[model samples]
Target: MSSTRVSGVVVTPVAFADPPLLNVVGVHQPYALRAIVQVQTDSGSVGLGETYADDAHLARLAAVADVLPGLDVYDLNGLRQRVSDVLRLDGSAQVGGMLAIQNPADVVLSPFEVALLDIQGRELGRPVADLLGGAVRTEVPFSAYLFYKWAAHPDREPDAWGAALDPDAIVTQARRMVEEYGFTAIKLKGGVFAPDEEIEAVKALAAAFPGHKLRIDPNGAWTPATSVRVAKELAGVIEYLEDPTPGIEGMAQVAGETDIPLATNMCVIAFDHLKPAVLADAVQVVLSDHHYWGGLQRSRLLAGICETFGLGLSMHSNSHLGISLAAMTHLAAATPNLTYACDTHYPWKTEDLIKPGALDFFDGSIRLPTNPGLGVELDEDALGRLHEQYLACGIRSRDDTSYMQTVQPDFTRNTSRW
Candidate 1:
């Protein structure tokens, strides 16, 4: 066996403070859930990966961790096979429904694949970007991802950002994000309000912050007709309109009617979705989330496919901490076609599980961390603290629709409500 042979794996579930960020699904939970994966190798290297901490996902992760020992770090294909074997026996069941993905193997395999990539980079004394390919850009730009949120969760004191229920509040949130993070591109999370209301919010953002690239994702809340109307109105104002409607056929309908490029994280997820999406000319941009796309190298393969089909590539995010951020920055740096500023929810959080000073943000982008193996040191104390919070938080899985229903009993998720 190689020195990079796996020794053990530790999967720790953690919870961190999350504001009530509203979206198509529902409001963000009181604390965002994530599983921190540490893959320890025989050579004394530990690589970190972050992923959704839904109870089912955590169970799958634990199962894989049990079988990871003795597998070589560089044997990514073998790793996938092992993950596939374990998951097949467990029976394929989706962890959650916030996003649609055809392959559960991709979901279960992602974090372990990322951890192995980290181990490989550490062993070779190179950045993950170098391993992907040499860095195409030293720093990666990220968009200010604005959400329509409440002042606070029910029965809780107002958090810092306050309530953003209207156009003015959205613009105010944009101002804060751009001012503090220096983000040049801005995106709004739509599908929570009426189409016209969301359109007005985008208009207000355009007036408030001229020259900033803007886009809105409605998460398939509107029908094709409504999506077309909104897209036409915001044609010149938005850089692109994301997931305005659902399904490849639905997106194709919207695409046929508008000049504005359509993008999606919903309909066009997974490798198998690529051919059908391209054939329909349904979307122009595909947002890559490594957590769902099977980690860094496989995500690179996705980039190549997007390039071949002449599609714009952008990265997607969840409520993540620094380890995921570091991995994202490195991947984006190496990806040539990922020219669009990627989306991030980083500025919304006040706490992190990584040690300070591993990454920096000043001008709408993050400079790559130069240290080996993802370049961010895990904070053991912080991990323990967050793990404690997770146990006390009592949220085993995310149920945003139910969470939103608690706040507004009448609330329900609608794919084409408008």
Candidate 2:
């Protein structure tokens, strides 16, 4: 193992323009926040990482930086303990809320872990995938992530992606994406409307693109009974029903009654969640995300546990840019049990911090980077501009429900509304 020690670490919070996409939670804000982490080694090599950029997360990352210097990049467990110590000292250990299920320390450790791996890969002259047990495939497939949205935010100028609320409008949105990205699978963000209306949307998609793998995730907004009803309605047409209801018991109840495979990013969110989820048979498939699952290595561990239990494995995503996409592609390419196409929000993003022409999709798949340490370079100019936006943008945290209430005064969160 290479023995290069980390010399310094820099974390920058940035904001990028996001389309007003709608999901079970609510509409996405105009701009989304993400923090870019750069870990510098004594050899003058810098490894990059990306994660959520809210105020709390940013504070946790700063604490991670304080404990990184003089640490060996190969000692990941030591890094984890240091991060935990910092969070405990700062009284930020209990940063869990409705949005994320893991403790704040675990969540914050993900980006630093990725960065350390990047540094190790660079020193050893290997690709990130090679560091993660080598590549099992050259290209990783991705699904078209469909969402409900207005032409624009309440009073803002319209985005390039026009309004897509009803069945016809959603079909048009899928066609546009398919024409450009060649995605063979589709995953719609559901629970925006009633279950019946959302069922029509899925039926319309099936008719529009026959034999395509289709999915709908309502983010656990439905009751078990309603979830079962929707699953029965779409039976053979839908590949899987994602997070239709909340909690492990609720998901298991729906899974018991339906033939459709139940997948979740909501219920089985962390490592501790695996035992109960597997024991209860709550989910057939677990959608893995490196940002929240500790990091790429831990995500690989997640794949192993799922495989041992005879469960399916897929990937999850958030509103992000090329760096995160590059990391996801590397990790996905290295994992053997990831049978389903991963989810990505790349199409909806118009701006990127990475150098132009470095990352692109072909046939709905991103090719694994062969260059050392992720093989993607950041655009300093773009990063600076986005950082400026982050400073000027008043929004520090993501609250889709609050943003939605600006248009609908009677909006309230009802997990079993359907």
Q: What stretches of model 1 exceed 4 Å from their correct place?
A: 89-97
- lDDT on C-alpha atoms for all candidate structures: 0.90, 0.88
lDDT of 1 by residue, 31-137 (tens): 98889999998889999999889887888899989999999898999999998888875344454447755557888888888888888888889988999997999
On TM-score, the candidate that comes out on top is: 1
Q: In lDDT terms, which candidate is top? A: 1
Error of 2 at 344 (Å): 0.5
In candidate 1, which residue pairs get closer than 3 Å at backbone N, Cα or C atoms, i.e. clash?
Answer: none
Per-residue lDDT tens digits for candidate 2, residues 259-376, read 8999998888888898998888899999999988888888999999999999999999899988899899999999999989999999999888998665688898888888788878
TM-score of 2: 0.97
**Each prediction's Cα RMSD?**
1.3, 1.8
Residue 18 lDDT in candidate 2 = 88
- Per-candidate clashes come to 0, 0
